[model samples]
Target: MDFMGFFTKKSSKDTAKERLQLILIHDRATVSPELLDNIKEEIMSVISKYVEIDKDELEITMTTSDEEEGNSPALVANIPIKKMLKRR
Candidate 1:
C-alpha cells in the first residue's frame, strides 16, 4: 500500500480562488468601486459640518459578492470605524 497518493493530492486552492472570483463579480455589479470613496468623503464632510470626527480613524469600505446568479442583488459592505480616546 503506497501512501504517496495521499500526499500527492492537489492542494485545495479552490476556496480562496472562488472567494476572489466572487468578489470580482460583486465589484463588477455594484456601484461601490465608482462612488464608494466619494460617498465616504461626503459622509465625512457632512458629518464634520455638524460634529467632529477623526477622519484618520474613520473607515469606509464596500463589499459585494455573488451568492447565486439572478437570485438577488450582489452587493454588500463591511465598514468599521475606531474612535480615539484622549486621556484626561
Candidate 2:
C-alpha cells in the first residue's frame, strides 16, 4: 500500500503553523491589524502613482530577521505591477 501518497492532503497542523507564524511576526513587529491595513493602503496609494498594480493581489506583512546588525523588523510587500504609467 502507498501510504505516503494516500495522505498527501494538507493537514490542520499546516494551517495552524502558518497562522501562528503570522501572529508571531505581527506581535514581534508590534503592529496591530488596523495599523497593518493602513500601511498597506498607504503603500498602494504611493505605488499606484508610479505604476499600475494589481491592488487586489497586493500583500503586505512585517518580517524580522536576526543578523549581524541585530534583529530588525522589515516591511515585506508583494505588489504585482501590471504596467508602468507614463510620465508627464
Query: How well does model 2 score by local distance difference test?
Result: 0.87
* Worst ten in a row by lDDT for model 2: 1-10
Lowest lDDT sum, 10 consecutive residues, model 1, at 72-81
Write model 1 residue lDDT over 1-88, tens digit each, in one string.
Answer: 2778546645469657756766665566575555767877778776655555767767654444335554443334323334433533
Q: Which of the numbered candidates is closest to the native, going by highest lDDT?
A: 2
Q: Residue 50 lDDT in model 1?
A: 51
lDDT of all predictions: 0.57, 0.87
Off by over 4 Å in 1: 1-28, 32-34, 64-88
Q: Which residues of candidate 2, in runs, are more than 4 Å off? A: 1-15
